[model samples]
Every structure is written in C-alpha cells, then in structure tokens.
Target chain A: MREARDAMTKYGRKAHAITALVREAEVHRDVYVDPEIFELEMEHLFPNSWVYVGHASQLSKPGDFITANIGRQPVLASRHTDGSIHVFYNRCPHKGVKIASEPCGNTGKFFRCPYHAWSFKTDGSLLAIPLKKGYEGTGFGDTQANGGLSKVKNVVIYRDFIFARLNDNGVSFEDYFGESLSTIDNMADRSPEGKLAVMATPIRYMHTCNWKMLVENQTDTCHPMVAHESSAGTAVKVWKREQGDSTETPMAVQLYGPFMSPYEFYEQSGIRIWPNGHGHTGVANSIHSNYSDVTGYLDQMVAAYGETRAHEILGEVRHNTVYFPNIMVKGAVQILRNFIPIAVDKTLVESWVYRLVGAPDKLYERALMYNRFINAPTSIVGHDDMEMYERAQEGLKSNGNQWVNLRRLYESNEEQDVTAVINGTSERQMRNQFHAWAKFMTMDMDKHAEAAE
Target chain B: MITEKTITDLIYREADLLDTMQWQAWLDLFHPEARYWMPLEWQQQDPVLQPSLMYEDLLLLKVRVERLTGERTFSQKPKSRCHHLLQAPQIVACDTAAGVFKARTSYIYTETRGDMLERYSGWASHDFVEVGDALKIKLKRVDLVNFDAPFGNIQLFM
Candidate 1:
C-alpha cells in the first residue's frame, strides 16, 4: 500500500507539469506498465473523457438495451419508446443490484430489477417498486425528477454511434472527436440508405493487458508483419497450392498471404496522421478496389451520394484509424472495436462489424467472411494479437526495464497540432496517445481559483 | 431400426476422432453438401433480424477447416483437445427422400489446456445421410445450454 501511494504521488507530481512542450514523443515507461498510473487513468482519463458506449444500431428500437462497460463502470444503454437514447448506471438505485444481467435484450417497456422488482422506464425514469406502499412514508417514492436510475451525464449520438461523458465539463463530442469524426462519417456515408446495421453478433474477447495496449496496437502499423508472420506465411503456401500462383487468387486472399511483401511495401503505401491524434496507416487505394461482391452496392452508393462523393468515400481505404482512447475503427473490413478496461491487467474488447444497409446480400456475406477469417475467436489474426498482448503485459511487469521506448521517430518531424506524421512503424502513435492522456489526466483543476484571483 | 447401442457407439467414435485430433477423418465423416451451424441465440420473438455466431454452409466450413489445418495457422499452434460425453440419444426422424437419419443427443463436453479445464453442456441434433454404403453427416446443430453466456476463444470445431 505504501509503495502504491508513493508511486501515485510521484505520477501526480509529474502529471501536473505535462504540457504541449513535453516533447510529444518519449512517454515514461510507467504509463504502459504501472498499476498506479492505470488506476489514475481509469479515474481521471476514462471517467472524465468521452468514451464510446456502443454503436446506435446495437439498440435500434424502443426497449432495445445493451449492457456495455465504460472503463469498469457497467452501463445500460437503452432506446426509449420516444426514440431517445439513455445511458444509465446498470446498478439499481435502491439496493444497488445490477438492473440487467443479460448482455443485451429488449426490456419490452421498462427495466425491472430482479432483486426487488424495482422498475424503471426505458429512459431510466423511476416507474414503481412493488413494495411502494412502505416507501410512501419516507421520501423514497419520487418521480423522474427526483429518484431514478443514475444517468450518464451528456450522451452524444452521431452517425449510428453513441458516446457518453461521465463529467459534463471538458468538450462536446464534436470538439472531442475533431477530425476523427470523419471516420464515422465516411463509414455511414458509404451506405445508400445513409446507415449501416450491426451485421452479426459481436465477437468479444478478453486480453490480459491494459486496454490501452489493444487500442494502441490497432494503429501500431509495424507489428502486423512480425506478429502475423506465421499466419500470412501459411496463407501464401495455401494460395500457391490452391491457385497455383499469387495472381490467380483474389487480392483479399493475396493480402493475407506473403508476410514479407506487406512490410516491405508498407513504406511505399505511406500513412496519414490527422489533426486530432487519429492516425491512418496502410494501403489507402486497395480498400474498395476489385471487391467483386460489392460492385452493385458501390454503384448504389454512387447513385445515392453521387459518383464524385462516392469515389471520395470509397477511396479512403485506411486499414486502421485510432479515434484516440477507447475506439478503434478498421475501415477495410468495417470492424469497430472498443476496449473497456477491466483491471490493471485485464481488458474486455467488444468487436462489432457492420453491413452496409441496402447493399447486396453477397456484400454482407463478404463482410462476414472477413469477420470470421480475421476477427473471430477462431481467427488466426486474433489469436496472434492476443498472444502478443498477453506476453507484453507479462513482460512489462518485470524489473528488467524501467521505460518502454517511444524514441523511434521522435526527432524526425513535428506537427503543430501535437500530431506528427512519423514512419508507420514508429512509436509516434503511442507517444501521441500519452500526450493526449497526460492532458486529460492533469486537466486544470484550479480554474475556479484562477477565476477568483 | 437403429438401436441405441449403435447410435451411442457412433457418437462415441465421433468424439474419439475429435479428441484424438483426427481432423481429416472427422472432415471426411461429413457429406459433400453437409450444413454445419451454431446459430446465435436471438430474442425468442425476432430471430431473423439478429445475427448468429455461425450460419455456415459447406463452403465456409471447408474454408474454416482449411485455415485451421493450414501450416500458418498461429492460433492452433498447440491444438485444442476436447472430450465429448453423450448422455441421452433420441431418434427424432428418418427421412427416406433425403436418405437421412435424424437424432438429438444431450452432451457434456470438457476441454483442457495445461491445467485449465472448461466444461460446456449442450444438445446436438445430428442429421446423417446414407450415401451408397457409408453414413455421412448432413447436419450437426449444437444448441449450448448457456448459449448467451460469454465464451472464451472457441478455436476448435465444436
């Protein structure tokens, strides 16, 4: 306990001095591996900032509710009868029993706690308790204005995505997202109906690492070649056996084959770092090229949004886009994953892929193919990632290293907006994340004092 | 008339094949057009709108098997071993047109990894089609007892 307190104090002191001039590169190793910093991050970083709850499609209609965690805080996101969305603390207001036990379901009309039968409307308004007569004598049986399920402050929904802020202060979802919102926009804009539906049951996984590691790994372009080497190498041999040559197989299959080619070609493909710490790395053009199954759907997109706009939307083939903090969007496969920190060492990831509404069934099938082959529990890619994450977590706990280096592209170049366009393999993304992290953790608490002065 | 002993023996042999990691022989047990599925548990009211864990056809199943046995498959480096125990096998129906025998069997399956052991109880509905002299699997639908519960990596063919 004493050691923990000392570490906390040390972090608290250093965090206070963090500024834009703190060399946007080179984060203290403690940030990634330390338990003390992880605890502080849960309190200061996750709770205070806008964290993704789930996609709006997950709860499309009235009584539709899905249980999701926002950094260890279990939340129930429901769509009310009036078509408004509510994110509420899952715990019952009375005796603190969890309101819903299932991962997701339609409550029909209201949420009823199994423990005491205390019910709340879909909007989380207090409806009635079975033993209300006993509570009438006290000040307990109040209406929505007084007693109800605790609502998450400031909920924002944009383009079928839901984000919530526990603290009302800080920034609006627009300001918080900045240019990162384009990833969401581009995804939705591709659909002819201007919407996408959650295509399949989400594949959930638990990784024994800080949630940040998984989030960072999404944009860490360098690891794919090394980490997925075995999978890719095998893919090449299989393709050779089946198709007899690489040219005969489809690009999707070819991309998965031959690990060496991707790493070598990645430099030519280049990466683009956006204004708000969101980075896009990998082959941009191949995302929508020669997807035979989606050709008709692409035509519809061209018709709905116009050919020029459609081209622009389809042209942005960013493999991974880090929406800073909790959300990581994979544009190529239309997979969105959110990392919810379970503990200092464990992270719960909910992976959801979408089907472009009004698109052909074959297109949806293609998406499912990618989901099953690349992201599913049985996936070779997912297994490799999980192994690395678990290993990294175990390695970081050792006394062998005090700091993890982020000095790869530290001195090459700098961006005015605190985002640098470093080599895709550089640790710039991790450094950029910590830069944003320190800002949120040590936010000016003395604003009122300064105002009073 | 298929006796209980014959059905039980067949099921036990199938489990043995899987447990012993005889993947190719297991694959051969299925008919060319076999449909294997593990559907997601949807709300009792609306089934079509929601997605399932698996709604695979033969092609997809072939791809899955190919990938699993593929040399580069990293997830299967240390293969998974499962012990399937069938408690009750009830004959559901016999279709002459399809030349298929249908049966539903309740099972308890346990998988061990090092010291970690996880158990799952489920009922499987098997459809077997007799082609010439051999019996081939037409379909194997497994409905887990706790279908909605969060599961660990389901790496193996369940």
Candidate 2:
C-alpha cells in the first residue's frame, strides 16, 4: 500500500503549511479555504482518532442501522442479530456501492445491495453473491477478510456512545478522552435509570463555513455579546413586555438574554479546558436556575439513589463540551451536536437532544424548547450565528487578514500541556483545539509506514 | 353557500397584510388558539413528534413579532419586504353547518432584505372557521416546495 509515495508527500506538504502557524496560536486562512489541506485533514487527522459515529439508542433493534461519516468516509452503525452494535464502512466490497442509503432504517435479516445482488449479514460479513458457479477456479469466489461488505477497523462503544476509526494504530477512545468522560457521566447520571433516550428528531443543517469555525464558536464566550446582542436584546425587550412592569427577571430571559452578558461576566464564569481538546463553560449557570422541583420526580430520584447522590447528579451544570474534532455535547440541555465536513468551505451539522430516563416531564420539555428556539435552522438565535458564520467564511476569502487570531490570553496562559481553569472569556479553548489539531494533522507519517510493514 | 371566491379574497387580504408589514393586523385575523405551522418534513401531521420550521401559537407569535419589529433584531436590520403572489384558492372541504372549511392555495413569496432577494414558493393549507359573518384562521400550515432542500435565512412567512 505504501509503494506509491506521491500522495503522501502532497499530504505532508499541505499539512506542513498549517502546522507552521498553528503552534504560535495563529492559523492561516488557507487551512480554512484550501482544498489540499481539507483532504490532508481527512487523511491524517480524522482516521487516526476516535470520531463519534452514532449513539447506541439510535440503533434500537437488531438490523436497525444509522449512517454517519468520518471525515470523507461513509460509515453506518448497525445492531447485529446477537444484539451487539458494530460500525462498518457502509460499502459493498464488490461494487463499492453504499449498502444502505437512507439516513436510518431496518435491514430486515440481511443487507442486499441495490445495485448488484450482493448480500451481507448485519455485521457486514458476506451472505451471498450471485452466479457463483461460473467463478470456481477464479479467486473472486474466495471470501477474504471482508466477505461482501467491508467492515470498519476499530469501533469502541463507551456506555452507548459509539465511536469508530477508519484506520488503526492511534490513541484509543478512553485515553483520547481522559477526564472528559466525567462530563458524559454527569449527563447520563441525571436519569434515575442511569441512561438517556434519544427522544427528539435529529436536526441536520448546512453551514457555509469550514467546520472548525463552528467548533471554535462552541466555546467562544467573547463573540456572543457582540454577534448576538441584536437577537438577545430583542428577546429581553419582548420578555419585559410580558412581565408587565414586574421587576422579577424571567428564566426565559436567562435562556435567551445570556448572550448580552459582558466580558466581565464570562471572565468570572470559570472556563475549564481539558487535554485532548475537550473544554467547556457555562458551569456557573445551572439548568435548575429558576424552577422549583417538580412533584414526585425528585422523590423518585431520591428513591433510586438516595438524597445525596440525587443532589449531586442534579447539580451538574456543564454547558458545552467540544470533544476534539467533531462532537460537541451541551450537557445542560442534553443535546449533542456533530459537525461533518463536506468540503473546505462547507459543513453539515447534526444535533440531537437526549431525554434523561425517569426524569421529570418538564425537564425534557425545557430541553426541547431550547432546541427549537436556539438550534433550529430558522431559530432567531441561529439566524444571528448563521449569518456571522457565512460572513466570516466570505471575509476569510480576502487577503486583507492572512492570520486569524487566537492570541486572547496567549501570553499568561502559555502552559499548553496542563489542563487549566481559565477565565470563561479566554481564547484558551480555541488554542487548546489548535494544539490537538497540530498534533493530529502532523502525526508521524512514520507510524503509517510502520503499520504498512 | 360560502363560495371559493370568498375564501380566496380573505386569503388575499391576509397576504396583503403580511406584505405591507402589518403583522399586528394579520395577527388579529387569527383565533386565539390558531396555530401557524411550517413543518420540517413533508406532510408531517404532528408538530410534537416532528420538528418544525415555525410552530408558534398566539403568545409565541406575539413574542416573535415583537422581536421582528424591535430596534436591534440584526437579521432584520435591512428590513424584509414581502410580496406574496397566490393563485385562486380552492375549497377542498367544507361543513356548512359547522362553519368550518379547508382551502388549498399555492403562493410565491418574494422577499427582499438588504441586497439579497430570495423567493419561497409553497402550497398552503388553511383551516378556516366562520364566526358571526367573519372568517378567522383556525390553522395555517405551509408545506414549502423546498421543505427538504434548505435555504438561508428563512425570515418572513410564506
């Protein structure tokens, strides 16, 4: 596989261009606009790391499948007849066609390729191929490593969260996400059943900028007050009208009006950036901010785990956890947003809200309302951010500014290796991502060579 | 008998109110329980199970109207001007005794905001209720032609 060395050099050369500036807390616009760098990111970065595929609850039954993508590679998660979840490359080995084309559906016993008559099991092993009598002497009849469909190499499921890698020999999922699993744990532990159900329909929307723009914006505490002031301010006026001169601020105001918070507020909010490019904020704000506990729900939780444990579980208020390359978990709202890269200038973002099992009905309803009012494509808040993303992509095309700034808190917070609890307003999260970005993009090609041998 | 022309004329009045940016006047035309829905999926019957582009009741619509007319709604900074062109609506179903009817109308919504001009064309299904010689909107559901294929900045109603 390594005999033809031309493409590897191109990948190396394209990646080197971004690697030079990313170390200095600065990245050139070419990384966001260049086609070669996009391909290199797919080849070098995504395949070597654990990219989130789908949640286990998405594949509810045997033969149920949900399709996803890792970088440019199409993948699907399917439940086997034996009741285990597996991730595969989603292609027939013979014709290289997509086995299941829909976003999700049941394969009903086995997968039959629509183009050809090739058939495979739910786990992607070959079941049947037509006209076998003609190829007795030919090696085409032989069932190789992949019988009919090519199986994905590495799949790791951590408590219903499924992740897969297209290639091998890299950081495992557990090591890649060190202490960040606690965030996931805190989210799942909210349920008395100690799990979550994918309750809402997933929303897929296209962004007109590079995927990293959305990633960086996840923890960007500074841009909100400036970029979203228009929408948030409008929401506040409307809320005040509803209150009819009452001085009491509504919880709905905090829900939509937090975008008007100044830099000083975010600075005191306590942002924590973890290793492996995981970071989060909004811990200062609780989901249980304004409401008294619902009847019987708290007692049910207490009955399940006693009082202290229930309080601990309900007290977790994580805002956003961006897991390196693609996954962003908004724990407070129980929503997961994944960014899939299509090209250098385009991205597809899919978000799904999870319902904590055995939790209060109002709790799930609040999350649903938040999803509809904030994340939906036509949402008032999303209208602001989407416009900014499109404008940012358009502005980056200009040569006026070659380097995008990540210099916020750059000098004082120079300790790159250690996880630090910086101010919420710091750009440390963006820098932290680029730190992992540099690592993944410039991972030693010698490792690939070693694997080839 | 309530003719199709009567329903078509009523719809045209509603469109005129929207195009003229008379949102409050248009809001008054609907019943208190009227639902304005634009589904994300084609023929999505229930708004509870499926996500929607716009699913605003009277109170929610009032809040949105306030925002749209506010000073700092940046998405509306340049202001959106709408022009709705519709074919003659057909009365699909009717119950004369119950004062209820359903009309199917197709429209082209041309909107100009800032320097960009975008158009949204769709089939609109309206469930109307006649009350004391006046027709009030009970439910207005819009099924966009590009309901699946997405576009940018869906500002005005179709």
Candidate 3:
C-alpha cells in the first residue's frame, strides 16, 4: 500500500505538469507510452474508479463464479447460494492463494481453497478452515471481521452487468454512468424478451498498445477509412462477388467489409456527443434498414415494446457508445468490449456478444457473424486495427513528437449537455474520452485520504 | 468393422495434410455436405438453445479458406506451423443408413509462431461417410480441453 502511494505521488507530480498544458480534452502523448503513468493509473484510477468486472449472466445461478481482474487486482465474481452476487479478492483469507483457478465454473455449495482446504461461502463468508482448533485462541477465527474474503467496496449489478468500485464513497452507478447508462438500456430494450444473455465465451485478445487506444478506437469514426482500408477493401470485393452489386450482404459483413466506406459516408451521418463523455456517431436509421437480418429483430422488438418506443431504441444506430473509460457498447452488433489495462503499453480486451432472448436465429447469427468474421482474433478487419495500434504505440514511444493531435474538429463544434454534435470525421470522441479520463485521474486525492481517515 | 490400423492411418493422413498446409487436399477429405462444428461451451441447460463459437457452413468455410489463402490476408503473413499428435482413437458408433463410421480421437495440436509454442489438447469426434472406396468426414466436432480459455488467433481449422 505504501509503495502504491509513493508511486501515485511520483506519477501525480508528472500528471500535474502534463494536465496543466494538455487540458482536460487533450492528453499528453506520454500517457500512452510512459510506464510510470501506467503504474500510477493502476494504483489510483483503476482501484478507485468503477471498473466493470463481468456480466451478471456470467454468474447467473448460485455457486457459479467467474474469476476476472478489476484493473490489476484479481477479483472473484461469485453468485452465492442466497442468490446474491459477491465480488471479492480471489485470494483465500488463510493463505492468500487464489481460490478459483478456472476462468469460470460452479463451486457447488462453497469455495474450498485447494492449497489449505480453507472454505468460504460463495458470498465470501468464511465457512470453515481445516484444523480449526489450531486457531482456537489465536487472532484468526471463523468470523467475517476476523478474515473473510476482502470484498470490493461496492458491487453494482444492473440488468445482468456487474460493476465494482474499490472505493466506498463516490457517485452512484446511475450518476457515474449518467448518459452512458442509456447504452445499456438501449441494448436491453432491443431484446424481444427485454433481456440478453452472454451466449458464448468472450473473445479475448492482448494488444501491444495502451488500453486507451482500444477505448479511443471504439468510437473513432474517422480511422476506419485509413486504418482498416485493406480489410474493408477485401470485404467490399468479396461482398460484390458473392452477393453481387444488386443484393446487400448482411450488416455484420458490411460493417466489417465496407468499414472504410462508412468513414467516407459518416461525414453526412452526423456525430452526436453527449455529456459525461458518452455519444454515438453514424446515421441511425438507414444503417439498420440496409441490413435485412436486423429487420426481423427490429420487428420483434417493435412487437414487444410497441412501435414508438422500439423505433426510438432501434433508430439510435450508434456505431459505438463510450461507456466512459473502459467499456464500449456496440449496440448494432449487440457486443460489448471491456478494456483492461495491463501496462502503459499492454492491454487485454474481452469481447462479449449477447444473445437477445426470443430473437430469431438469423438475428443471433448476424451478431455471431460479426463476432467470428470481424472482431475474432483471426479476423481480417481486427488484424488491420491491431497492426495500426501497435504502430501507434511504437510511434508514440519515439521522440518524433511530444504531442498526439486530437485537433481534427476543434473549432467547428460547441459542447452540449445531452449531445455535442461534431463532424462525423471529428476526433471529438477522443477529446471527450481524455477529458473524462483527466477528471477521474485528478479527482481529489485528499478526499480519498479523508475517507481512509 | 473399421480396423484400428485403418482409422489411425486415416487420422495420420489428415494430420499430415494439415501440417503440410495442403488446405485444398485437406478440404477434399470432407464430404461435400459435411458439417464442421465447434460448439460454444455453455452453462445453459441445452447447447441447442445457445450460440456457438463457430457454427459454419461450406460457404463460410470456403470464404475462410479463401481469406486465409489470399495474398493480402495480413494475419496470415507469417503462416502458423502446427504439429498434430493423435492418440487413443476409438470407434464410437457405426451408422448403417449413412454408411458412416463414427470415431473419437484425442489429439494434442502444438502450434509454433517464431519460438513461442502453444499446445492445445482436444478430443475430436469424426463421423466418416464411406463414399465408394474413400472415407470422407461427414461431421467433425473438436472439443478443446481448454475450451473456455482466452485464446489468440485461431486462423487455421482445428
């Protein structure tokens, strides 16, 4: 803890200088490249802020658990026998050994540590420890206060999505999410049964770039044209040959193949930025209408939730919704990507696409197609983005320039609370993200100290 | 009765084709209407109701092969090298109507990129449809030992 504090203080000094000239909307190039800033981010930002752990659907039944990382800290998200969810340190209380080794499984009744046979309830209560008489008069006892699994300060489970905050006092999940909550709401509202389940194992990848790169790319409407040119070009040619010029390929394929074309077309689509750094960019209506697969899902949604409400939900064709910081909700494909920063230069990305309950097989297939063809590790499109991100990271590390520009549409647009509409090709999303990042990073360290006191 | 030697020989031939990257020849080993399925490991009550990691038809598989073999497939720039070791081959069932002999085999597929080695152990169940004198796979299902582990690019057919 002391080492973490010292590291935070050292990096905090650097941040002070960096933040002064960079502004809230502008980030220093070193933030993406510097190891010191990355360590500090792990200590300060990651631990204190609300980090998404996993989806509630992942641990749906009692005794079901998924082992995941909250920033750098290993957290076990378990569904208790009482039907409540608990997010705690994966380490056992007795010996600090990780209880659950597998990514996910059912523990049955209780979690028994393999090392010492120390058992704990799924909710992280100490159930039993081997050789109980050894600790009869000792400091350690089978009590919650004595030593249960060190629980996260707060765990918020909303609509099967689980978020945990290490810090006790802060904004409520709703307040913290603010405008971003609508992304989740929109995702759920699209489902015919008004519920969604993670139908498959998350497609995970490691990128040799800053985690911020992945988050920024999630909604960067401009880069698809230049960065993803090769893949998109191939997609277009294939679609042309397979479906011919007259027929339209599925939206998933089109999204992957003609991704570059969208960048060219997005300028006319009009990008809308919301306050709290959440926004969407793209023509909402025509994009959906273009895809025959989505029409059936949209019809089902309309039937379930009426025409007006369903139209409002389905009409919001957001290519990406920045749930601020790490989570990105791609509503069109019913996929969500959570960015986990490993180092300043290393990031682990988990891609999960949900199955809208009661939706047609075709609708699910559309999302599955996107998952397999576009975002999967072997994806032509993903490889392009991965290569670009790696190059960007390498370039930033060089002494070529101190500043990375987000000055694309700087003077063209005014910031609005609900929607800050910018040019489709603008870097406003990047600017908005950095602004939110700065706010979270520099937010009162003294307040944290007071809370500790 | 399908002899153990015959099944082993068939598996060895298939592995050799894959290891040599004879993709077209490998494709010929599958029946025209064969199904290659790698179902998603679900916690659900029924797998039929759930989505899969790969539920592919011949059209998709053809496209996948085309992309992998394409000149501009960036991920395939430095091609993946693989070694398949098949063990414990067993004839599970025989279908008289389809003239298909179903067999289960455990394999350890070791892939190498540069110096990095990744070994994946999985059990593969193949439904072999006897066509004339040749045996073609009517269905091939691979269930990886670590089916749920976070994986990197699986560009090649497993």
Candidate 4:
C-alpha cells in the first residue's frame, strides 16, 4: 500500500505533487474525487486543525458529555467535576473498544466501559479497574500510558463553543483563526445575556459529495441566484400570485425570497476574506438583514448593552462564515453547520440552531423556521443545492476537464490589515481555501519546527 | 354522521393525493389553519421550543408545492415520486355532532428521485374537522421510526 501511494502521480498524490494540484487560478479535480487525497486529508488536515466538538451548553452540567469525531478519531468531550471541559479519546485502553457508544449522555461520576469494568473519571484519569489483582505482576499501569483514556492534546473552548485538535504541534487556535473568531462572538452576542445555547438535536443531512463542496458552497454567493431560481425564484412568483396588487409580504416569502436576490444586491453586500481560508459574505447586508423585526427582541438587546453597542452588534450583518475545513457559522441567523466527511464521495452535514438567551421566543422560532426552510432534510431550498452537489460529484469523474475553475475576480482584490474585501460573487474564497488545503497537505513537521526555531 | 369507513376513506384519499403527485388536491384537503408537523424527537411536545424535522402552516406548504411544480426548479427537473403503503386507519375519536374526528395510521412511505430511493416507516395521526360538509385536515403529525437518523433530501411530502 505504501509503494502504491508513493508511486502515485496519476493525480499528483505525492508530497511535492500534492501542492501542484492547487494553483493560483484553478484546482485539479482529483482533490475532490480521489480517495487517496481524502485519506491524506484525514491524516494531515483534520488532525492538525481545530475541529468543532460541541457547544458548552451541551456539557453544562457535570458529567454531561458528547461524542464526536475530530477527523477520523472518535473523541469524547465532557464537563469535569472541576467545571472545566475535557476531551479524550473514546477508546477503552483494555480491549480497544469504544468507551462511550452513544452520541450523548451523562457519565455520572465516571465512564465505565460497557465491555469491561475499567472506569475513568470525567477528567479521563484512571479511576478504578475491577480486576486489579491480575495485573499486579504485569506491565499494566493505571496511568494514561497503560489503562486510562488518552486525553486529546489540545482543546479550546472559546465563548462556549468547543474545539479539539488531535496534534499538539499544529497552529494554536488564536494563530489559526485570528479575526474569524468574531463570527462566533457575533453569534453569541445576539443574546441579551451574551450567550447562545444550541438546540438539543441537530438536523443531520447526508450529502453525496465531498465535504469541501459544502464548505465552498457556503461562500459561493454567485450560485444562489442561479441554482435557487427554481426554489427561491418560484417563491417570488407564488407570493406575487397569492397577494395580487397587495403590498404585504408573508414571513414564508421573507424566508425564501432572498435566495433569488439579484446579482447586484449580492455584489453590493461584498465579501470579507480572512487569512487561513476563513471568510464571510455580506459586509453591509445579507439575506438575514431583511428579516422582519421580532417583537421585544430589540428591547432586550438594548437593555443588555447600551444602544450604541447593541447597534454595533445588530448592524454587523454577515452571511455564511466558513471556519475552514469542516464548519460554517451564520452569525446573522444563529445557524451552525458542521460538515463531517464520511467517505471520499459522501459527507454528513449536521445543522444546529442556537437560541439567543434572554431573547424573545419568536426570535428562536424564526431561527428554527430558517433551519427548516433552508437546512433540513425536507427543505425545498436545500434540495436544489444538494442536487447540484451530487451532480458535481458525478460530473467530476469525467476526464474532459482536469481542472475546476476558481478564476473569477482572482486578479484584482483589495487587501487591508489581515483581511481582503472582494465582490460577493468573487471566487477568492475558493482560491483561499485551496491555498490553505495545499499548505496543510504538504506541511512537514520537521521543516515547520526548523522554521520556528 | 361520519362513520369509521368515511374517516378511513378520507385518510386514504389524502395519501393517494400525495402518492399521485396531486399537490393542489392535497393542498385543498387542508384547512386554512392546518399545520403539518414532523417532530424531531420522540414525543416532542413543543415544535416552537425545539426544532422539528418539519412544522409548516398552510402558507409554507403552498410555497413548497409551488416550488415543486415550478418549471425552473432544477431539483424537480427529474420530478420526485412517492408511494404510501398505509395500514387500515383506526378511527381513534369520532364525535359526529361536535364535528371533531381523529384517526391514526401506520404508513411506509417511499420517495424516489433519479436513482435514489428512500423508505420511511412512520405513524400518521390526523386531526380533522368538518368544514361545510367536507372533512378537512387540521393537523397531520407524522412520527417516523427513524426520525433521529441522518437522512438525505426528502423531496416530497410524507
């Protein structure tokens, strides 16, 4: 297998060759289609990057835990007795069986592996082993090296959103995200109490396409007007027919109509590209800006923060903020989408809606409505996007086009400070993502350390 | 007096309308204030408090049907089709004079588009009311057996 992988030049799968697949204006299609490249991503990209685990609200109580995957590794994030969040590998050191089998539950005082009675505390320290006498002469020990759950190297909980990285040598969270952390801050700040609680269950939708396609689509503002014409466009026609000569538009129309917004509107909204493949659309306004005012919601925001601060929070309207690789957060709408790669050709997307604490019920209801209308498995608007993704997955198999174009507005872009601003329809986000992809894919630990030294 | 047979017939007719892609007819069967709800969790109480798989009023349902029938809707270019295999509906509550009728049915619904076909087994509970001699759907709550499982695009009404 190593020889076959080492000899890979068909799609440029070698170390030096991987960077060649991504260029300034275009990317080789194999990056999205090749299983070997996907394996490399699981190895190099996902582990080295901070992946979202769960919201702190999920582990609000002691012993509360959620099981998630940081790339290919199954991990458990739990609230310890000390009130700190801890992430550990889900594997039981005894028989290598998964300690926590369910997605989420309380671990009580400690996690007792169902396979064996070997137990570990919420902090992942070895607590008690039932058959300790048998291992007295053996080499087994109670420490992490022998029996306890292995803790993940790095875990960061920024403003209640939890993230874990498998490797300690990778870039720190602050260095990796930088200004893009504001997207999370913005979402949390919408609450009068300055906190966001995730709804209990997420709407999980499986996509028959590569995970990158979903990430790219979040920032691909150009496609909505064209791809959603069937769903969002028809919504306009229906509203017109339903309210002939009437000036009033319904809430349903308000939700679905913006996907058919003209190109000029999106272009004027603008896009902000941050470093490390992170970016968001709607510098001035977005589809979320037009939502009708929720009763009493503004009053709560005003009471929480003074008028000026509240205005600053509400005024900063942004659309899908791609956190690079796996997650996208829409601060304007309180929606977070985590894209979990299942296979080379399959991805599972979990869409979570957060409730702005101390806000009116109507606001959270609207968020839920938006989740149903746009991200649910039964979403009419989401189906069109899914269709396009599936089509792209199937079409990329052809040898006719070796490269996928990301040339739109690549040449001329204005950069100031650590961020760049481009037209909303520009493909700069895609190019930025590919740049990060190549960097992560080709990174050498030895070289990185030498450079740091 | 609305008999059990009449209630079962109405339930069957609703399923048939969906299965045959008679969206307009299906829409007509709904009361003006009708709500279609598919709860996310088992025995989920409040659709407003918790997120639901689907919870839509008549207006939203109309928009979905409109989109389904639209020419430009590319997802429907290869229009999705469905078949409902329903068990005999049991008339849970029948109050003829007061104009309140309720029925429960077990259904296996299959939706297909292109080469992908998904099968879902669920229980459909219907709340009905008489609107000028016609029974109309006030609420249709569907509880899928695998409601918590990860799913693909469910393109049609179930």
* TM-scores for every candidate against the unseen true structure: 0.84, 0.90, 0.82, 0.96
Error of 1 at A155 (Å): 1.6
lDDT of 2 by residue, A54-138 (tens): 8888888999999989998998889999998888887778767888888788989999888877888898888887786665777
Candidate 2 residue A351 Cα shift, in angstroms, is 1.4
Models ranked on TM-score: 4, 2, 1, 3
Deviation of model 1 at A332, angstroms: 4.1
Best by TM-score: 4
Error of 3 at A256 (Å): 4.1
Candidate 1 chain A lowest-lDDT run of ten = A13-22
Candidate 2 vs candidate 3, DockQ winner:
2
Query: Across residues A1-453, which tens digit of lDDT does each residue of candidate 4 receive?
Result: 844544543432355568789878799998899998888888888887889999999898999999998777899998999998999988998788898888888989999988778899999888888877888867676444464789996988999999887877877899889999998999999999999997678898989899999999998888988899877887787778777677767777888889888989999899998887888988879988988888888888898898999999999889889998789998888999999998999999999999998888888888888888899888887898999998999999999988999998877543422588879888888888888888766664344433343
- Report every candidate's CA lDDT: 0.69, 0.78, 0.72, 0.86
**Candidate 2 local accuracy as lDDT?**
0.78
The DockQ assigned to candidate 2 is 0.45
Better of 3 and 4 by TM-score: 4
Q: Which of the predicted structures, 1 or 4, would earn the higher TM-score when compared with the native?
A: 4
Q: For model 3, which pairs clash? A: A56-A160, A273-A420
Candidate 1 wrongly placed segments (more than 4 Å)? A1-33, A108-147, A243-261, A286-290, A416-422, A444-453, B1-9, B42-79, B94-97
- Backbone clashes in each candidate structure, one number apiece? 0, 0, 2, 0
